[model samples]
Target: MNADELYPKRVRSQKSDARRNLSFASRRRNPNLRMCQLLHLQHLDASESKINGSSICNIRSVTSLNLCGCTNITDMRLIGICTLPQLTRLSISWCVNIKGHIIGCGMSNLTYLELRGCDGLRDVNLNDISALLHLEHLDLGNCNNITGASICNISTLTSLNLTGSGCITDKGLSGGLSTLRQLQKKKQVTGSCLHSMPSLRRLNVSRCWRVHDENLRQMSTLTKLRYLDLSGCAVTGSTLGSISTLTHLDLSRCWDVTDVGISALSTLPELQHLTLCNCQKILGATLCRLPALRVLNVSGCSQITDVMLRAICALPQLEHVDLSDCATIMT
Candidate 1:
């Protein structure tokens, strides 16, 4: 009589049951049609699925949605997504069809948003996103159109990824990041100091060629930073001297950094993961000075021979070491 009562018998049948087979095929073709019945669904990962914007609107209770690599998604579909009142985390990475003016709607509960490689997204308005007071983690990596002003208002953000977003310049950091340092000082005076001085913990600006020494000087004020990636930027060893709070640092492809710059890292007592891939100038003298160093990536550092390897092996805490492409290292 009912669809549920008939499904069990249909599945057990060996005969060519046309009605039962058609029903199963229909459900497979339109998975969203069945998902609409699941009112309590909290997480939906319809990534790379044929599900369109209209189908997504049916799942109203979802809090986390990952539509990454869904090239078919458009700006109109994003409008439907805003209506989901419980949504807090959304990842639309590589969704190139999602263009301008798509974020300013009713996503007040959103805390984490990822728009990496969203090529169509241009002229994004920060005013729309500023309403999300709870927003913390944002990844605009490879979104070339993003400027500094677009993120200046989001002072509540803790983790930001801007890798390959070269349009962002020193002016952008001055406007947005400067406020974070001020907030940290205010929190310290109020005796609400948590783990570090600033709320920001992780930041990646790799391949952002416009970022230079002055920007690093400004970033040094974020005393709470534990993870920082400045690979492929225009900074020298002098910049490393400014930030002593960093634990995980990635300076891969930083050709300008020499042995003198490596010495500055000695001040970071809590340093652990250090990536110096392609830093050919470092001869490995300062490598042993890091007392807490655990993971070290010195791949492509041809200057590092057995002498450097000996110093690296002497570190009692060292666990993982990347000596790939080192011509002088014996075995």
Candidate 2:
């Protein structure tokens, strides 16, 4: 017999044992049990396992729950998790089949939530989140279907992550975040994030192919943005110049951007991490001007010459550099 036969997998967690049957043999001696402060329920190994509806209901006291990579489970199971009032943090990444339609759940106490890789999630039901007055941190990355309309309800949120969610135009940023400005002062709300949800210190909007420089201008109101990622976007140099306060920026795969556009990007004195991968137009001269840059990724920029390599070396603060796949860089 293997360990599987010796110790059968229990449906209810060990924590439920406290609320379960209290028999004479099991209860005669007091078993010293420790309470779990946080619970993460992921399906990394059991991606195809179907979550039993009844078993899911048994987990009530869990404050933090993760259901990432659980491909087999539907939105119904996720809805079940959100109904719990005590939940503070939740992650449901990579559950591709689940639709983004959230409605009628009491997510009032949630402070941190992650909804990455739920590609099918389309409509975010704002009515469900209006009561979540205490919510702070949220991540909606990689949900390409959700438009800016869904964000209209959660303007009270502070730290938001919108790394790869789709179809967020200038109107969306202006509509969603601007409404938030009414709730608090500039210091409380404005940071790197666009519109009014400004307390964001770090933001990632990479691969959002539709966003433009005008959208970045809306973000200039956010002076507190320390980390930003604009990789694979269509923003031009004019748009990049609008966000001069960024400390970390990733412009990899931004095909439309040229060396002229990046000229203003190097002006940020606090910039530490800069990535220009696949931005085919950038030369070595623009790379050398970044004085505070520590980590720079220039892979796939074919226009860089040997002279630019020396320029890159000239930066006093430069530390890490990626010259991979650039055929013309000097040896």
Candidate 3:
């Protein structure tokens, strides 16, 4: 009897995927398959089943695993995945039932881990997770229960995404900054505040209602920052000014940000991807000044007109542009 069938269809599909994965793992008859060698596995809409953890143990060669939208999962199933000594990348976004630690001691080698939308997750021991020194990317989006204490330990992290993590505040981020010394050189630690992650390359704190630019400005110390998302944040023009090396900027849903803030982006000569979705105050003229711009999304910006579209087209590197929902544009 397939216990998975008795549950929702999502559960059934998760079990089916696990079965297929187990079958594939069983086929790898070559014992010479190097565990340290890189491997990539992407499974969309994965569900949780009792069989998944055991199947993960069989795929010793897998290094990167992306299981996006695996809502049917809880914590125990992912424990099996942690045992893989070479595993690095793992994305379990929208996996609602994953309430606690799935991989503790075994995740020492993990470089990238995304737990976005794991709403039920409330507790995570910072000490256990801080062991992963190789970590570069981590996403904790929409986990309202997580507090600042757990985040404080991950100072070695380079790329972090906390979009919609409502519970986080400057206090938690500040704690994280304080602990960064052991992970990087002393010069990398510039700001006395939370944003002082010196080696950081990508930072997404969008919709973190509690965070303000005062603490966020400390991120200017990270001279290598390439991507920054301040949408729905209290960030103003000065915040953008600090990050002059940014190549991608997303300021969507930022009602407080006006043309003055948009102008600050012009200082970023490397900027290529820009999203100004629903920010009505920025004028069409402001869009034309961006040099080296390629992908621009101005959806829901009613203030923009055909002139704004023409300005975007004038950019020699512009390859993709989206003006959807812009009421002022007729064609």
Candidate 4:
């Protein structure tokens, strides 16, 4: 309920030994119990409850609210929910009817927000969200009427998901880099953590068909990224090599990936979990080179034969692997 679906795919791909996240855990580790005083720990779960619009505003003192899969949710009810003074984390995923730009209505305290699968949210103003100074984690996956250029203007965000958003094209990404850096420079001297936070630590642009290497390779300002998903994108891996700090990467169904590009991945010291499923080009020749990889998925890679499977199984640090649908690999 606490914006848990913000990293939906990441949670599903995890293994028993998935690397621990110390990013937000440090605050929870503090010995002084009072130091970690959270805003509002109370939560309301009206998700799919068929709750009416008038009754929606009656809820109070709630900080985290879950309205996932709520088919009857209307714009007015959503507006009422957003007006909750203490609301900080909200998930309106799959809410079919939410429209209008009124999400910014009295919602000045939001830090985590998820609007996944809400295609009705289109033509919304960037200022309505940029006004949310504390917003850090945001998911706009599968939403309509979004432009990559507009997203780059929100300088305070740390994690962003634009999965299946056709608005993300190569031209837009190339232009957004300049817009991002310009915003970065304008807020460089700000002392507030809300304004001074660096570029995205996690990003998901899966199923964005128009994202190619011609635009992706030029964006060097995104070097701070740790988790990246380019699943079903048409990148050839030129930019993947430059993101050396990346620990988790998903390149599933990236058809253009080849030995040259995959070989470049061996140099990534911190990378652990990688998924290259359905990639027709992967032959497993260069995959075993990633000796430090812990979890690997090469499922549906038709070119991976039994010899390649042996090579993959020999990886020193590999703990888990998926060979499903790889008929060529008889072993």
lDDT values, one for every candidate: 0.69, 0.60, 0.62, 0.63
lDDT string for model 2 (120-200, tens) is 755554446555777665566666766656665775666555555545443444455532321211111222235555555
Worst 10 residues of 3 by lDDT: 181-190
TM-scores for all predictions: 0.75, 0.68, 0.64, 0.69
Looking at candidate 1, what is the lDDT of residue 191?
16
lDDT of 4: 0.63
**Decoy 3 TM-score against native:** 0.64
Instruction: Write one digit per residue (lDDT tens) for candidate 4, span 231-250.
Output: 77787776567667778889
For model 4, the superposed segments whose C-alpha errors exceed 4 Å read 1-41, 68-83, 93-98, 117-124, 148-153, 166-198
Q: Which lDDT value does model 2 have at 30?
A: 43
Q: Order the numbered candidates by TM-score, best leading.
A: 1, 4, 2, 3
Colliding pairs, model 2: 100-121, 100-122, 177-196, 189-198, 189-199, 190-198, 191-198, 192-225, 237-261
- Clashing pairs for model 1 are none
Name the lDDT of candidate 3: 0.62
Q: Ten-residue segment with the worst summed lDDT in candidate 2?
A: 181-190
RMSD (CA, Å), each prediction: 9.6, 9.2, 9.0, 10.8
Q: Kindly give the stretch of ten consecutive residues in candidate 1 with the minimal lDDT sum.
A: 183-192
Tens-place lDDT digits, model 1, residues 209-266: 5556655766566777788777876667566766788889999898888888888888
